[model samples]
Target: MIEILMWLAVPYIVIGLVFSVTHPDDVRSLEKQVQTQLPAGADALSFGAATLLWPMMLITGPVEEHCDVG
Candidate 1:
């Protein structure tokens, strides 16, 4: 029973971790979509506030921009 339970739990654990990691950007992307519906620049301050509140600014946005290639 333990072995069978472990097998079933493994996939659930992996998918849970995947979704936990991805959930933030899902929120951010939804925010961006809402921003698009508004006039230009409306979401900029909200994003800036969120990014500033976030602890890892040094780790994220710059890397994202660099990855996008001009």
Candidate 2:
């Protein structure tokens, strides 16, 4: 049971780490959208939170809207 659970969790953890590294700005944008600021090492905290809560982050979409008004 433990092994099976570990297998199931691996994908989430790996993907979360990749996302955290690749889209760091998204994490900051999310913090801004939520209107909560953390003092010192906030980026690290945000990355950690994002890694754990990546599924919810995906559901919520990007925090910043990029509308091309041309």
Candidate 3:
């Protein structure tokens, strides 16, 4: 019975590990998206802010209408 239980648990453990490491957020893609939405000739401050806030922006959704790429 113990051996049977271990076999059943192995697949679950493998899949969980795979999913845990596989996040969909790509940093470069996020930067490009930010650039598209930003105003022309915006300062480095704006770019820096977007770089810092990207994870939160992804979680909370875009603050501006044009921020959405698709």
TM-score for every candidate vs. truth? 0.34, 0.66, 0.32
Write the residue-wise lDDT of candidate 3 on 1-70 in tens digits.
Answer: 9999999877755654443234234333444565666645334434444454545655765454345544
Please write out the lDDT profile of model 2 over residues 1-70, one tens digit for every residue.
Answer: 9999999999989999998778777777655544345666666777788888887777876646542212
Cand. 3 Cα-lDDT: 0.50
Q: What is the TM-score of candidate 1?
A: 0.34
Which candidate ranks first by TM-score, i.e. highest? 2
Model 1, 1-70: lDDT tens digits are: 9999999877765654454344455335535555656657645643544444343433464333443322
Q: What is the total number of backbone clashes in candidate 1?
A: 0
RMSD of 2: 5.0
Error of 2 at 8 (Å): 1.4
